[model samples]
Target chain A: MNEVMSLLKNHRSIRKYSDRPVGREQVEEIVAAAQMASSSSNVQAYSVIAVTEQAGKDKLAELCGNQGYISECPVFLVWCADLSRLKAAAERHLPAGAETYESSVENFIVATVDAALAAQNGAVAAESMGLGIVYIGGIRNRSQEVAELLSLPQLVYPVFGMCVGYPDQEPGLRPRLPLEAVLHWEGYDAERSESGVKAYDETMVKYLRERTGGMKDTPWSVLMAEKLAQPARLHMREFLQRRGFGLK
Target chain B: MNEVMSLLKNHRSIRKYSDRPVGREQVEEIVAAAQMASSSSNVQAYSVIAVTEQAGKDKLAELCGNQGYISECPVFLVWCADLSRLKAAAERHLPAGAETYESSVENFIVATVDAALAAQNGAVAAESMGLGIVYIGGIRNRSQEVAELLSLPQLVYPVFGMCVGYPDQEPGLRPRLPLEAVLHWEGYDAERSESGVKAYDETMVKYLRERTGGMKDTPWSVLMAEKLAQPARLHMREFLQRRGFGLK
Candidate 1:
């Protein structure tokens, strides 16, 4: 396998980080890499706020379901799906424009994809620099507060957060679905693909057992069932709507 | 600047690709890097189908608004926001379960984010390998046919497509919005961020004028207005709804 490929295959989420401060130069490079990501129609409807201040990071950690790493990491970045800039541009260019360019579901999708692409770029760049990063999606749990803390405009919403630093521990790569399960040749085959899921479940179970002392003994299927059975996950839609995304 | 940062800073969307096949090993590595991307709660609700066959690429290209590069590129990959696997997993684990899963908007978001994050990783990894790539959002222009062509099951939609190969031309680095335009200090600030747009518009106008001659001389704001003024983009919701994502 290629060296980069090996790094990718062995990648594990690093929640624990060394006590190191990421330099301004590295931060600029990471954000620049993020900006280079392809945008929908090149709109680039996303922005990232780097929170290096301990106070701001602590506040973000609180907003993101009290994830300790958010405050501990050398760099904390909030990836936002932003449309406010375009809205401002439109207003400045065409004062009579009646098209309410607030957060619509379509725009939300664009911004989210833009932010995700950029953040992924940043993550890859960080990894290449021998840094470890983990995405903090829990920021959406308290969307309103996050928006306030970040002072996001009406058309901007915090999609997620990420913590970057040197890894303090080496966690094993989490198992993924077998290629057959996820990859379809010509057309999608649900039944044909389910067979691959069985193998994936076994693989995951073995991985969990070996790594976490069999605490999560259930197969992948059962674990997913428990997750979906809850209603709290559905709260994100309401939060998005409240945050100005009329996902109509 | 780091080599990776330099590569990113110099990144350009390479629509014109050389007629060379991307090897299977490279494909696997890229896909593996994609899988390493963070997912919402580890759901990993997405899949990628590598299309190497010319006929298949032609069909996809036709379906995706007849983008010439889709057929021209040696390697084409369709990234699907997939929830069918989870639905099947649910059905297998809890037959006659009351809690329906497939027809939910939350699941769609999860799948889209998963697909986007993974595709971004794939893009960066491909870039790291000295390959050129471009994303095809035009795939969503004809979502139903794309779903049918990919044999996508209910609750599975094609979010986008990616074409990866060596570059045919060395395109310059595209300009982006100034950091101030997108990044908010605290809370949403429309008035404060407005100034940044002016600077960005000047930067982009100069870039457009220089890059593609005066023919493609539309300012970023004008291009965005044209995109939003049309109803063609609004059809995505209906298409997604028909594909079984009950956005209610």
Candidate 2:
């Protein structure tokens, strides 16, 4: 594989960061690369909030399940699925249709996908620059608080957060489901999927055992089964609705 | 910037592709890179379906609002926000809790984000290999039909499709919202956002006029205003619920 492909394949989440500060110029360049990502209908419905101040990082870290690395990392970014700008544009240029800009599930999906695409580009760019990065999805655990902390307006939701800085430690790449389990042919294949899952269970059982030094040697199936069965962020639907999304 | 950064910044939607076939080996490598992308809580709630047969592509293109390039591209891959495997895994390991794994909007968001991250990695890898790609969001316009065509199971929605091949055209990199418009410091800077939007509208007016060969010219605000005011896939809520998502 080439350098770019190698970069894509060797991704590992970084939770420990050195004291070295990430330059503002580097962050700008990375965000510029993120802006080049594809958007639904070119409606780049996403915004990123960069937090470098210790106070803000401290608050964000607390809000995001108290992830200390969020405060330790030199730069923390919150990627938001933002439709507020579109609403502003609509009101300014087409006042008659402003109210119609109310968010729907589809629009929410678009925004979420756009945010993820752009954020992934930012992650790749940061990693390519020899910086460490980790996605902070726990931010959703307190979505309302994170939004208030970020001063996000209606129609803008903090989808996830990221930490970027010089790596203080090296981590092994986390194993993923086998490609056969995740990639189908022209259609969904039930039998192939079942078999793939059985194989992947074995793979993950070994991986988790090794990664956790045999203290947590649970099979992947058991983990996912338990995780999926539990309600995650049960208040999310109401939270999104109150934030002017998916109400349609 | 390095090669990866350059590739990220120079991204352009490739709607035209040459007749050369994409090697299966090359695709597997690309997908291996894709599998390296981060997933929410390591759930990996997504899957990809690769369509290479002419007949399959034709049907997919038709399902995706008659996007001809989807059929013309040497490889078209559908990225799915899939929880079916999780459901299966849950059933096999915890049958009593299987039904509780029914989808919620938060889970849907996780799936969408996971799919986008994986798809972006695949796109970057494909571009690194001198191939081109364009994301097809229109697949959602007729999501049920598309799902049926792909034999997608419940809890597995086709989030988007991607067309990949050797590029037959070199389009200019599309203009994006100004960096200041999308990147906020600490929290959102409302004043800066308004000003940035004003500036970007001017930039997009020139870009749109030039890209369309002067046949049409409209400010970014105007286009976004009109598009955002209209209902897009208004039936999506019911559709998702029917597909075993957003039921919560």
Provide TM-scores for the models: 0.93, 0.98
lDDT at B113, model 1:
84
| Candidate 1 per-residue C-alpha lDDT over B1-248 given as tens digits, one digit per residue, 9 for 90 to 100 | 66656666777888997766688878887887888788888888888888888898999899889899989998888899887777777777776754865555567766888999999878877877879999998887778878877778887888889999989888777788776666554344566566777777788888888877875777788777656554445777787788778765
Each model's TM-score for chain A is: 0.94, 0.96
Compared with the true structure, all predictions reach lDDT values of 0.78, 0.88
Worst 10 residues of 2 chain A by lDDT: A95-104
Q: Give the per-prediction TM-score of chain B.
A: 0.94, 0.96
Docking class of 1: medium
**C-alpha RMSD for every candidate:** 2.2, 1.3
Which digits, one per residue and each the tens of the lDDT, describe model 2 over residues A1-248?
69998898889999999878798998898899999999988889999999999999999999888889998999999999999988888888878535664667888888999999999999999999999889998889999988998899999999999999999998887777777888887888878877888888898888888888899878888888899888888778899988988556
- The regions of model 2 sitting more than 4 angstroms off are A97-101, B97-101
Residues A1-248, model 1: lDDT tens digits: 55555555666788999887788778777777788889988888888787888899999899888899998998888888877666765665656755754555577678888988888888877887889999888887787788878777677777778899999988877877777776665567787678988898899888888878877678888777666655444666777777677776
Name the TM-score of candidate 2: 0.98
